[model samples]
Target: MSKGEETKTRILQQAAELFNQQGYAGASISDIMRVTGLQKGGIYNHFQSKDELAIQAFDYAIASISKHYRIAIRSKRHAIERLQALIAVFGSFAENPPIAGGCPLLNTAVESDDAHPALRERSQQAMNSWLNLIRRVIQTGIEKAEVQNNINPDEVATIIVATLEGAMMMSQLYNDTVYMQRAVNHLNHYIENNLKINGTS
Candidate 1:
C-alpha cells in the first residue's frame, strides 16, 4: 500500500477500537487524534468528516469480527458443529474481542439506536449478515439431515444471536466471564439436546 493508503488504514483500525470502546458521541476528534497520533488536518485529509470516519471505522470493525468467525468455522463440516463454533467465538469475544472494546454489533447497536442514523444502519446491516449466516448454517443442516427438517432457521438464528449478545452484555457489565460462559454452555447444550444430532434423536 502507498504511504497515504497505509496511514488511512491505520486510522481506521485505531478509530474502530476507539469508537467501540467509547460510544460514537463519547469519542471526540481529540480522542481520534490521540489514538492515531495524527493532527486534525492530517485526519481530515483522509476522511471527509468525523461522521464519514465513524461509518468507515464501523465497517472495518464488523469486517474484523466476520474474519475471525470465518476462521473459527473454516474446518467444521457439520452444521451443528459450525453453530457450536459460533458460540465458542462469542465466548472468546468476552476474553479477547476482534477489537479491544468487545462485540461491535452489541456496542454499536446499544449506542446508536434511536441516536445515530448512519451508524445505526451500519450495525443493522452487520447484524443482518450475521443472522443470515446462522440461518444458512441451520438450513444446510436440515438439508444434510444433520438436524430435523422442521427446524426453523430464522427462529434458531435469532435465539443464538440474542442469547450470545445478551450474555456478553451481562458479562461485560458485571466484569465477569462467567455470564458469557453460562451462555456458551447453555447454547452448546441446546444444540446437543434441542437441535439433536441426525441419528442421535
Candidate 2:
C-alpha cells in the first residue's frame, strides 16, 4: 500500500482497538494519537472528525470480528459444523478477544445506544449480518437434511446470537472463562440434541 493508505489503515486499526476498549465517549483523539503515534494533523488529514473516525473504527472492528468468523468456519461444510465453529470462535475470545477489550458489537451496542447514531447503526448492521449468516447456515442445513426440517432458522439464530452475546458479557464482567465455557457447552448441547437430525449427530 501507499504511505498515506498505510497510515490511514494504521490510524483505523489503532482507533478500533481504543474504541473497543474504551467506548466512543471514553476514547479520545489524544488516545488515538498515542496509539497510532500520529499527531492531530495526521489524524485529521485522514478523518474529517472524531465522529467519522469512530464510525470507520467501528467498521474496522466488525470487519475484524467477521474475519475471525471466516477463519474459524473456512473448512466446515455442514451447517452443524459451521455453527459449532462459530461457538468455538466465540469460546476462544474469553482468553483472547479479536479486538483488545472484547466483542465490539456488544461493547458498541451498549455504549452507542442513543449516543452515536452512525456507530450504533454500524453495530446493528454487524449484528444483522451475523444473524443472517446463522439463519442461512441453518436454512442450508435443512435443505441438506443435516438439521431437523421443522427447525426455525430465524428463531434459532436469534437464540444462538443472544446466548453467545450474553455469555460474552457475563464472562467479561466477571473475568471468568467458565461462564463462557458453560454457555458454549450449553449451546453445543442444544445444537446436537435439538437442532441436528437424530441420526446425523
lDDT at position 152, candidate 2 = 95
Give the per-residue lDDT of model 1 (tens digit) for 82-125.
99888898788998888988898899999998889999999899
For every model shown, the clashing-pair count is: 0, 0
| Candidate 1: residue 41 Cα off by (Å) | 1.0
Candidate 1, run of 10 with poorest lDDT: 192-201
After superposing candidate 2 on the true structure, give the runs of residues whose Cα lies further than 4 Å from its correct spot: none
lDDT for position 92 in model 2: 91
Instruction: Give the whole-model CA lDDT for all candidates, comma-separated.
Output: 0.91, 0.91
